[model samples]
Target chain A: MRSNTFKTLLLGAVFLGAGAVAASAGTLDDVKAKGFVQCGVNGAGLAGFGAPDDAGNWKGLDVDACRAVAAAVFGDPSKVKYTGLSAKERFTALQSKEIDMLARNSTNTMSRDTQLGITFTGVNYYDGQGFMVKKALGVSSAKDLNGASVCVQSGTTTELNLADYFKSNGMTFNAVVFEKQEEADAAYDAGRCDAYTTDASGLYSIRLKMTNPDDSIVLPEIISKEPLGPAVRQGDDQWESIVRWSHYAMLIAEEFGVTQANVDEMKSSENPEVQRLLGVGEGVDFGTPIGLTKDWAYNIIKGVGNYGESFERNVGEGSPLKIARGLNALWTKGGLQYAPPIR
Target chain B: MTLRDKTADETPRSWVRAVLYDATIRGWVFQGLVLLALILFAVWVVHNTAANLRAANIPFGFDFLNMRAGFDISQKPIDYTLDSSHAQAFKVGLLNTIIVSVLGIILATIIGFVVGISRLSRNWLLARAATVYIETLRNVPLLLQLLFWYKAVLSVLPGPRQGYVLPFSANLSNRGLTMPRPIPGEGFEIVMWSVPVAVALAWAIARWAKNRQAATGQSFPVFRASLGIVVGLPVVLFVVLGAPLSFEIPELKGFNFAGGMVVHPELIAMLLGISLYTATFIAETVRAGILAVSTGQSEAAFSLGLRPRQTMRLIVVPQAMRVIIPPLTSQYLNLTKNSSLALAIGYPDLVAVFAGSTLNITGHAIEVIAITMAVYLALSLITAALMNWFNARVALVER
Candidate 1:
């Protein structure tokens, strides 16, 4: 009687464990079956990256990348779902499969990728650490900052960079740390710190928040390199490839003169490279190997435009940020943005 | 033939008795199996972590602790730099947490005791004011209070160029509250050591006077004598050492204060938020503890010709402490844990430095998080152990 009872309990436990394994596997397969993509983004903070409109519609450089991926897979840019996450919760949200891809303005670092068990596909924005001080301080350069108090956001690469910069210069300075960017900005504005330090792009966003934007000037010095990119979970090669190719497609489109407005017109061109990119004639099998539609690159360019177009529209000369495309420009244009050939 | 049959029957009875007698051994074997299973599970987890780390091409070691932290901390209690190792950075973070918690606890206790006493006061306005204070602070989230203090209060202060002058050569500005810093000379060390010695002697004298009164039923002016010794001895040492301390007053220079010790506004806001929020809960605990003692006890003491203050001191406080101590210890632990919120305001607490920046730089999330959690757990356990010893001393003794 005892042996029979033990056998029954063992069978029940085995069945429950198998059920759990099957359920998890089923979820992954379900995601693959869905043609569209779900990408997480930061909502309505920094301009040129992620910001919301008066109607609450999100748009930015990162948001465009998510749309590009959605267009590549489902042939519909609107198929993407944007999950807005805070800094503290972003990693856990991605790890738990709440979002298939995180294309937010997340910094690409060894710890975030390897330690957090996430993979950064490629760099989207090349940034550097810089400081913004009040113009009245009469400080033209970061080297002048000796024993100056700096306001910085906590839990970011900027904090470490700040320490390294000050110590390397053998200068002693007080740091006023804040968890949120807004709080740090507020502190900086109130003169809690003599200067505010963060990513160059972040310094621009913060400067815009100042009541008198002209009063604060970002110093000429760039402290450390910050390569921002989209990240996906490990062990998901299919998803990673899709995200990577979408970004490359934009770069290739720009090299080939494909803008959102002119993509349809470019379809009739006789050029061999354009023919292959639009999936018009021969070598149309590139998208098939990646499980995408034949006109994947076409949909991407039409939906989100080329890389240069996206940059100019969001954060470049046309936007409030007015960020110059210095290192972010194409390699042909003496910039670092080069992609491997699609074919 | 009958004797042979009885011997065979005894064999069956012996087998049944053996089974019943071995039950204790069986129970012990079951418990041992459970312990072994737990140990094996832990080992398996460690093995998996090691394997995963190897596969990811990451090193599994604490060598990173000696590497430069490279991150700036805002309110380090000790001298620290980015050139310092990860270990030194952690020490700086831990010290900042300790500084905030210790200061918060002292302030909270004083506020709590006064508010608690006022809650039971005969005056209506005093009781109402205390009630309002407790209700307003305790209801709000601690994080919001921290934000309000940092943003709404401290951040609104004028810049150093337009510093607000307060009494006693103090200046309030967005930079921080700058006050006179006392510079200690060579002889100051000797005077400092003498003060503590005088305090110890006074404590010894107080104990001697109490024992004499208990034995001979005679009173001594212990309070007056102890106070005189503790204060007078410290003063005499300072004078004998030729008053080796001098004040370095802060002076405005260019756009900032040049001299004196400046307390950063982040530290001030964190302390204010922590103390005010914790004090409300502590006040409630104090009130409940005092109420736990029966009114009859106080009335009985009064009938014996003891004054109200004397009755409260000898009877009520001692009994009330029995109820108050356990909850007060938990409040202290909560305050310590809540110090992690210092990260929110960039105060460079343990979480902000070690678990945060170091974890990012090293990419060893699992190890860093495990270490941080272990540190907090150890702190909580130590506090609990200390409180338990105190509680045992004050526990009711029954025959």
Candidate 2:
């Protein structure tokens, strides 16, 4: 009787799952037909990435990436719809086909790609784990964190990195854990912990929210590599290419000096590389490869400018984050943001 | 007449006869068809998943669990490092979940009982206050409450440099509550062993006293005598062992408390939120259970010259428990399940660590999700089984 019941239930589950799979064609086909991308973003208040303004307008580095993809495909950046997701809901939303892409400051790792059934296109920001301590502690480096209370967000790479750093150094530190970065920041600021640790980019964003930013200093140490990038659902090869090339086009456009302001004029430039990037004179057939327009790169550059321009305006030297390019600079400038040749 | 009877004795068609003559066989055939369809469907899904994973160039395996978890865990009960295996990370996460769930259960029960009793209070103000608490808390979503606690309450606390001093060498700050940690000295192990031994001795004494009272009609003062032995024996052992215990008081260092156990604010907030939210529901359950035991039972006990305390303890509570156990079991399960909200505050619970981070790190969504679901299901089943056993013991036996 038990075996029979189990078999019946198994049959029901199989039919349900199969029905769901069969009803939904590939996500790639659906995305192309829609003509605009649906991107998920961090709804939390991470300043440089996805925080809202006082007027309630969403703007950030991650947000710009989504807009750039929209520009590349639809010729209008505003055509994209941004669905805000909390950290926990972000992946599931993408997996459920609620969003076409996730442009949050998500770290690219092997486990997420293969296990979670997602694919990270390429790294846009190279970050590292670091610690921030109050000035009164007189601590300059992570080495001085002996027996210190460290406030760390739980369920993050920072948490494990913190344990490793302390244990490896043979130091015993108390952990004042929080579930969210904002809570950890609050605790750190309120003297709940001697220090706060997270990704360096996050540290900067969090530090800006401190009441006395001058009283805290981020240690000049990078622990773990956090290669944050945009990702798409797995099995969507065409959509993946479109997103990947969209980001790469931004890089190539920056390399060729195709600023948003000069994009129209740059189309008729004498330089072959500039002309090719702006969709002039037998431009590389990006439209054919990714099932978009040949001028997809042109729309991207014209709408959001190139990578350098986006960085400076959103989170670089000009922004409140005031972060240096570091590894995010162009490959020719001895950084890691290298784009494949457009050919 | 014999020839006619012989002609009429011919059997029906074989297939018709099989269906008509055997109910079990018919049932088996029907069930078999359903099973075959299910197997075919499963094969198709497996095939699609394989194809999808292959196309994406992603390997599907559990080998990732053996790899080093390069991240740090802030509130690990056991020793953990970034170099620890992913399985170790998961264990740490599970331990954190258990810690929060246990604490939340105790707190919720206390609050629940108080509110439950207050709801029945004769005083108008007290009843209204209890009603307000239940209505307000039970209505709001738990996730929002957790976020509010973390973001609004705990975050607004004073920093470590300006820590709030509580009684008995404890500090409350945004960092968390810091308390004096007990450090074991030499010969402390012997003193620790005395605690359980003393309790066991007390239990034996109580049993003996109860039997004597029943047989000889003599009161032995079991409560007072057992209490003395349980309390005194441990203290005597500690003193005899030359006070082999010390406390490491939490001191304010340059900017924060050091040299003591630090509770993380995430844990504090999550615990507070879960306990407070679940308490309201538990309060309603307790009230309903108590009310389910008719007022006549308590009145009967009172008329027999029993004190109010005895009436409640001996008569009402036992009967009320029959009404309470099932729902109480569900409340406990709810608390355990709600511990998954630890993800909101980054508590690294089982779901957050294994299902979230590990799944992300390993890309084994199917396996990770299945494991997570199975763990929760097992926990719920175990809780239900225990409650069922308790209910059976307390249930009235009808001849």
RMSD per model, one decimal: 6.8, 6.0
Structural similarity to truth (TM-score) of each candidate: 0.88, 0.82
lDDT of 2 by residue, B1-399 (tens): 342233555556644665655779888888999999999978987776655444444565677789887665667889986678888988898888889988999999999999999999999999999999999999999988887887765557777767688997988877678899999999998887888898899899889988998899786877888889888987898898899878999887655566788787778888889999999988998899899988899889999998999899888888888888788889999999988877766566887777666654454555566677788798778878987998999876657
Top of the candidates by lDDT: 1
* Candidate whose DockQ is highest: 2
Score chain B of each candidate by TM-score.
0.91, 0.87
Please give, for residues A265-295, the per-residue lDDT of candidate 2 as tens digits.
Answer: 8888998776666667753564766667778
Error of 1 at A110 (Å): 6.4
For model 1, which pairs clash? Answer: A177-B346
TM-score of 2: 0.82
True contacts kept of each: 0.32, 0.32
